[model samples]
Target: MARILLADDDEATRDLVKRALETDGHTVSITQDGAEALDTLTSAAATFDVLVSDVHMPGLDGVALAKRAIAAAPDLKLLLMSGFAEELDRAQALKSANLGVIIKPFTLDQIRAAVRALLA
Candidate 1:
């Protein structure tokens, strides 16, 4: 089991992802946007093993968040989600060993597997 931090602006997406990961026995903490997720990552008492975030968000986008999160916690793993090809391309540009990307409209199993890949 892993301690995961998940960030997505959409409530339904957030809830669906939270449940999907939890079903896989991972402890998930959620935030509505990247800024909040960053706060949780930097200030929270508990250190997260992985970060699952949406690529497009209001204030701080997932790509920016990923960059900052990695700097703050070098060992943190990243899984970014997006339906847009351009955004996915942006996420891929980071090119970190611990980073991964999932397309939106994903099945629960797909998301679970993506997170599992990062953990593995």
Candidate 2:
């Protein structure tokens, strides 16, 4: 099982994702914003295998968090989620070879596959 850090401003969405990932046997740590997510990624005693974050957080959007998180945890696998077209485009423009974008309204299997792709 993989250790995961998940961030999303929406409480319901965060909870749903946490549960879904946990049900898949991944250990997940959840945060409400990118700043918190970054803090956890940089300060956690244990290393996370994946970072799944929403792109529209209030402080430190997902893309920015990904930048800092990669510096803090170079091996981190990143998967970003966004419902907006503009945000998705921004994520794509990032063009990091290790970055993956999971469009909103995606199935749980899609999320699992995205992370697996990065990890693989």
Candidate 3:
């Protein structure tokens, strides 16, 4: 099973995604804020196969976190999710970060497929 870091500001959304990923047999570590997510990635004990994060948050934000995380862990697989696809598209950092983007309101099937594809 792949180890995944799930970062989202919304508690409900985080819970939903976490349950879905866990149900698919993946191990998950969840963080409710972008800063916390970054801290986890930078932590000495932090290790994960993939990172799934929301694009917008109070601090740091997903694209910034992904960029920093990738800098620290070049091989880290990143999957970014957002309700605002337009905003994500406009964020040049996201494109430069080279991470996969999943539009929000995704189905469990979509999440499972993304995890499998990334892990594969």
Q: Model 3, range 11-32, lDDT digits (tens) per residue? A: 9989888999999889999998
Error of 1 at 29 (Å): 0.5
Q: What is the TM-score of each candidate against the true structure?
A: 0.98, 0.92, 0.91
In order, candidate lDDTs are 0.96, 0.87, 0.84
The lDDT-based order of candidates, best leading, equals: 1, 2, 3
Q: Name the runs in model 2 displaced over 4 angstroms.
A: none
**Under the 3 Å rule for N, CA and C atoms, how many clashes does model 2 have?**
0
Clashing pairs in 2: none
User: Residue 1 of candidate 3: its Cα lDDT?
Assistant: 91
Query: For model 3, how many clashes?
Result: 0
User: What range of 10 consecutive residues in model 3 has the weakest lDDT sum?
Assistant: 90-99
Among the numbered candidates, top lDDT falls to 1
| Whole-structure CA lDDT of model 1 | 0.96
Cα error, candidate 2, residue 95 (Å): 2.4
- Tell me how candidate 3 scores on lDDT: 0.84
Global Cα lDDT for candidate 2: 0.87
